[model samples]
Target: MFDFVRRHNRILQFILLLLIVPSFVVFGIQGYNKYSEGRNHVARVDGQDISQSDWDAAHRNQVERMRAQMPGVDVKMFDTPEIRQRVLEDLVRERVVFAAARDLHLSPTEERLDRLFKTDPQFAGLRNPDGSVRKELLAAQGMNSALFAQRLSQDLAMRQVLSAIGLSAFAPESVARAAVDAFYQRREIRVQRFDAREQLGRVQVGDADLQAYYDDPRNAARFQAPESVTMEYLVLDLPAVERGISVPEDDLRKYYGENASRYEQPQERRASHILVKAEAGGPADARARAKARAEALLAEVKKNPAGFADLARKNSDDPGSAAKGGDLDWFSRGAMVKSFEEAVFALKKGEISGVVESDFGYHVIQLTDVRGGERRGFESVRAEIEAEVRKSLAQKRFAETAEQFTNLVEQEDSLKPVAERLHLTLRRVEGFTRGFQPKEAKAEDAAVLASPKLAELVFQSETLAGKHNSQATEIGASQMVAVHVSAHQPARKQALADVREAVKAAVTQARAAQAARTEGEARLAQWKARAPDAASLPAAVTLSRARSQDLPKALVDAVLKAPAEKLPAWVGVDLGGDGYAVVMIEKVLPADVADTGPIDKVRQQYAAMWAGAESEAYLAALRKRYKVEITGKAKAAEEPAGAASK
Candidate 1:
């Protein structure tokens, strides 16, 4: 299972990205050996500490994000030395980018950062429709103002540095055109597939073979079960705390009086228009004709006010509102173009206006209805004001209380001390496995149990033996849990008697796969000898590298690279556990270059590659400019396989 981390590119790259990418860290002028490593500091950049808490939180989030993307992925697969090292490298690289950004004074500006807090997709999901960040939503995401602001500033600053580096990347026009021409060059080929699964009927396995295969150490992981624990935990719900606190009327009334305008709803009006065709630079009389037509429609609508919508449908040039019988829904002031806005706002409800000229054309305006803005009475919005005040007070109260909670849990043997002191319930979560299987795991237990860091601590030898309370794990901004293992289940291998049928099936599959590979190789050898123009086989189909087709990705990649030195070249792929597939390359084709290809497409691709190189080179330069020091256990994990942007 540890092989998953080695195979996952994200983990592999983070472990070795630093040495491979080569970047810098800025800090005070100090000799390397003079610096002492602090336990809290995971890695020191210049003189600043990248706190251990931050590192653990980042690793936890990365694992959770990966699990979200790939539901079948095992969490324990990421708990390897290689992955930890990679995560450190990612931090180091990020620091380097940030250092460079600081050197350029490219830190996120206040306005830009505010805009991001309100609109950047990651953080923006927590925003109200009006673009105000929701504190409750932010809390649910485990973010407070200070943490969010700091992270966002660093993220934006790094982007600023990278964008500046990428600015230097460009290609000559000729180079771009040639690259594009190569891209459009196409290839076509036919494949003859010999499926391994189809050949399974020819093979057989015995009981001896099954026992021998099961005994192999290489397959031990397949039979090993992960250690699990049934834990007892306690939670202090923040919302419940808020519910208990009652805000005085005087405070709510004071707040409302001080910010009365905030409670006011702005006036809104709805209008629909029938546009008459006109062109600013068309024939001389076109504008005049459009104005005359609008005037005629206006007089007719004023004569029969009820037929305004019918006239709009029959002759309105504005197709969007025409289909809806000229209903423009509603709009506040400054919502429409200046000329149209002024004309619509000037009219009374259900009033028809004279010809109103605007950018689109001359318009016959009709005012639908108007809503007058007003301030709500104190009674009308008391609940809203109270809820707001309570949330604000609760946040403050939580901050003050969290420190006490943290301190209490540190000195206690169990969560009982803290729960009893705070008048909170001691919650028990049972049968919690490291990897949360839906069938075995409880949905309500996910927030605490799904936390990788918390799970690691809960399952640690000390915690499992009931020596100490697991460290208080913060589930979100307002909630924390400290777990005590009530029951432990040590992982052990099943006896051969219990898994005989499973072992027999595995042995049969392995033997069948071997038989398929043997058959594929023999057939491939014979086909090479014959050297026929074409070989007809079962389940045969044609494919091309540059064309969209429905085939397994592994097969596509294998066939595309099959040596085409000779036409109808052959290749074989071992699908591992699925069997072998023999493929024949039927043709080698070139890109279409008769006419000049899409030069812009090739230029964009070249520009992207060029930008990445430029950015990497820029980081390497920063490494030379800044004084960097690796401390503590970080020395062993400095190498990282650098990742690239698309």
Candidate 2:
């Protein structure tokens, strides 16, 4: 039986076993690295040793992920020393985070593990009704329930630890409110551009200067074109197999019979409450005393005909609705705390409950109403049931039809004959770019373009349209199409006329920049003559001033690039689109400004920020203390195939 299962699909069997094994480490930075002799130690966070084997394996995984994103990326692209170092840094950080999480005692719950294993889309159709892990899929993913649970638990624990650390640091309300208001108030600006057409006509470019400017490599960069291509193609329509399959009444009835419980919803109730909180400037045993007083008040209210509202207003500690006589608008079960919910459920309509203690405080609840939780009558939900039944039938039939189509395409090597036999029309399209949108293309065509594989195939120069190729790929549910390329037009550089305005703008900007540079240098020389030293420099055509808070972005850019001692030196900057400016720094300030704002708010934001940095430093110190050693040689030996793939 084991051999038979393995023979069914080795890849899936291995995955199932792997899932049973443990959660694989997922760290950024991966590549292929071969040790000429023995494993080398990479880095030590505190004393934790990073092994070369683990680093190499993790790096290989990163390369695989990148290839999956852009399949044509060369393996050599990730072979640089910088790339390897980056991968090492990422691995070190991950180890630190993992070690810290373990120290903090964070863990994933059984419920969360179950959610992770079952809620995956791959297992959507595999689960049993009671929510137990599916046996077949568990075997397929190479994961038993226990192994999956363990791995899931660890991953979740790590996430919880990170979340706790991240949420510990929060921007102040002043910052949050400012960010929120900015987010809300942000508008797409549509600037009415001031045309330079009249002024540009008055300007003349000397032929010699124009030719010299055009010859400059920097000026020529703007005219460079991206490589493009067009391709001919044939698409097989395997998805249409579902359309060809028939849904019988017996199949629908069988599905409905087996899954009857899914069509039902459990019953629930609604109630309201008046709460007298325990600790509102009360005695030492405030909660107990409040509950006792609430009990007495509950009895009094029940006895009084119209005094329930008056009593609630006088005694309820809930400030939100105390003015409305402690009225808690309607709420369903699970909406209230456990103790309060239990009390509310136990009561009948118009019945008053005894004092109940909940996390909030002492509560006196009055049952308001109850509603049916059972499935609605069949007549009211007939249409819905029919749709559900139809979907089930469709899925079952589609599976069989898909298998047939797969066999047909694999054996026949053509979709034309199949389309003819099925009495379906074959469509042809004119020459189109891989990402092009044609007027004749439908929504489904857009979906095809959206697929990475289909898009790749469309752009692949090797894929010829007219000859037999792979069958039509399924882009979605309930839709199938087979297409043949009627013509092909290889991508070409666009005409200069198509980008004339852009070229003109680029040329104008170049001229403006040259003018700004010439003018700035002349002004700087005049200022330098008067000052003799940078310290003596004063307000002049070349001098511009900026404060810490109001530093002009152009000025900041120039200062950042200049020598530290030359900070206040005037520098010229191009602000794009033919704009330019000369700027200088007036002052420099430390990041921490004690009197800038409210001390309390500043303290709150800064403490959290500093704490995270402290935590990171602390973890690094701990790794150094523990002397964690990663066996690089052992890691490489474990996944040689992955390295080879990279």
- Computed on alpha carbons, the lDDT of every model, listed in order, comes to 0.69, 0.54
Q: Model 2, 1-646: lDDT tens per residue?
A: 3564445443343343233221334421121122212445665543545566667776786676566456567675676667777777666656666666677777766776678657775444445777776566566555566655666566566566556655676666666445333222211111111223323554455545554555566765555443232333333343343345455666656655566676666546655557777764556587777788888888887888267777777878788767887667766667777888788778887788887887677887776667655765555555565666556566666656555555554455456665555544455444444455556566765565445455444433323343444455564454433334334444344455565666555666556655555555565566445434534443432111222334346544454454434334455555544444444444433322333345466556566766688667666675565564443322222221112211
Q: Residue 407 CA error for candidate 2 (Å)?
A: 5.1
The 10 consecutive residues of candidate 2 with the worst lDDT sum are: 186-195
**Position 279, candidate 1: lDDT:** 72
Error of 2 at 224 (Å): 6.6
Q: 229-264 in candidate 1: lDDT tens per residue?
A: 787776655775686589889999998999899888
Top candidate (TM-score):
1
Off by over 4 Å in 2: 1-58, 61-201, 205-328, 337-368, 372-374, 379-383, 386-447, 450-452, 470-486, 494-505, 515-646
Displacement of the residue 171 alpha carbon in candidate 2, Å = 30
